[model samples]
Target: MIKAVFIDFYGTVVYEDGEVIQKVSQEIFVSGKVNDKSEIGSYWWNEFQTAFNNAYGDSFKAQRILEYKSLEKTIKHFKSSADAVKLSNLMFRHWIEPPIFEESKQFFELCPVPIYVLSNIDRADVLQAIKYHGLKPAGVFTSEDAKSYKPRKELFEFALNNVGLSAGEVLHIGDSLSSDIKGASSVGINAIWVNRNNREIPSGVTAVKNLIEIFDTKYFLHE
Candidate 1:
């Protein structure tokens, strides 16, 4: 039987703003267009990753700088950092509140097992999202708190340790194959992919587009 359930934040619990709703970005409102890491190259996406693999890694700070620069552009656009911060915070808040699924509230409230969060995000951001959405988690495990992102075994391991459980005792729900799926499975925690967009499940794991599917405790858990 499952003792606990770990859910991903973005994509699974909350959704990035789509065209239907206009959401603000605190970064954008307070600052501006974020730095063009692309100006550095497509490799810029991995800039943070590359730094991590090196001995003298300082990529988090570098990533923060990039964000700062991007926000700076917004400041130039709005002519005020305070306004940008307000707007951006509003947008950030939008992304977190209400969530992506009508079933989110039901499942969260009805889960038969303990529910927790395992996400690749800053600790403050995750807490803000949880508070805004009224998401009550038994525990929270974030990339910033773990000091490592998903696909890294330690990050998942950290959450498990915090909850005082083994991989077999919990089920992890997430969207990304590389991060959530692979990361949780690597440590023996069964992963259920929330492919809300109807994407094919990548080879190796089970997937369900709807959260309601996994709400059945008997499916993934040992009875």
Candidate 2:
């Protein structure tokens, strides 16, 4: 029986920084240095992911710093004059104050088990956001706390150890397939994908459109 839930903070509980990222990408495209706005977005994400995957242990770096460096590299790669600091700051602001999903409030209010935040974001950013949105999870865990990011197992392990629960006794819910699903599965935790976009669900992966669906009779029941 599931004793608790581990939910992702950014995309699961609140909106991501996609809007600010799109704006930054558009700015780069308008500079005429990049051929397509989509390319800018793709390149930036690739750079950031690469950096994040390599960051761990003594080489660990904060998410905000990685974001800034990735943006800097993207600008240089496209020969764009966009101010990396300014663009990164814009992204950080959104990360700290992204709109909370309407359903999140409802789900939290009615959840049967204790919910803890398991996120790949910086500690301070997620903590500030939780406060800003008036969220009170049982606990909050971050990459910074573990000195490692998600999909790496270290962060998940760190969170599990602190929650004092066996992997089989916890369920993880998050939007990212690679990070949340894979990470939780690595540690033997069941995961439910919050596929808000109606994307194709892979074989053996249970998915829901939103948090409310988690309580469906087909999934799990309250108590």
Candidate 3:
């Protein structure tokens, strides 16, 4: 029996910062000699992920700091004159005010189990977003709180301890395969993938196209 649900905040419960990232990337691309705008986006994401992967344990850095550092590298790589700090600030603002999905509101209203946010974002950003959207989750956990990001067991373990539930007692749902699915599974917790983009589902993994699909009797138990 599932006692609670652990859901991811950005890209899962609400819109991601893709638009703001695109806007920033476009500004950089326009200033730089890059031929393809997509290249800027790809490079920025790759840089951020590399930074994120390296951040853990004694080397832990807040997501905001990582974003700033990654943006600086991206700017330098493209030879763009844009200020990394300014662009990173824009991304932070968007993270704090991302639009909640309509179906998410419906899921919140109907989900029988208590829902807690288990995200890889900064604590303040996710908290502000929860307030901005008028959400009342059972609790919110973030990388800042655990001093480690997702795909690392520390964050998930921290969340489980706070929620007072064993790994098998809760279900974690999120959009990222590596972060949410792999992370949760690593700790013996069941997870559902919110594959909104119709990506190919891997074997033995359960998936849904949207939040509403979570209510399917096969995946969720009302009890």
Best model per TM-score: 2
Rank the models by TM-score, top first: 2, 3, 1
* Number of backbone-clashing residue pairs for each candidate, in the order shown: 15, 0, 0
Task: Please state the error at residue 154 of candidate 2 in Å.
Answer: 0.9
Candidate with the greatest lDDT versus the true structure: 3
lDDT of 1 by residue, 79-146 (tens): 44445455444545554463656778777887878899987665766778888878788888876666
lDDT of 2 by residue, 102-176 (tens): 899889888888999988889888898898989889999999999999989998899889989999888999999
Flag regions of model 3 displaced more than 4 Å.
none
Residue 136 local lDDT, model 1: 88
Give all TM-scores, in the order shown: 0.71, 0.96, 0.96
Off by over 4 Å in 1: 17-99, 217-223
Give one digit per residue, the lDDT tens place, for model 3 in 54-81: 8998899999999898899889999999
Query: Among all windows of ten consecutive residues in candidate 2, which has the lowest summed lDDT?
Result: 214-223
Identify the superior model by TM-score, candidate 1 or candidate 2.
Answer: 2
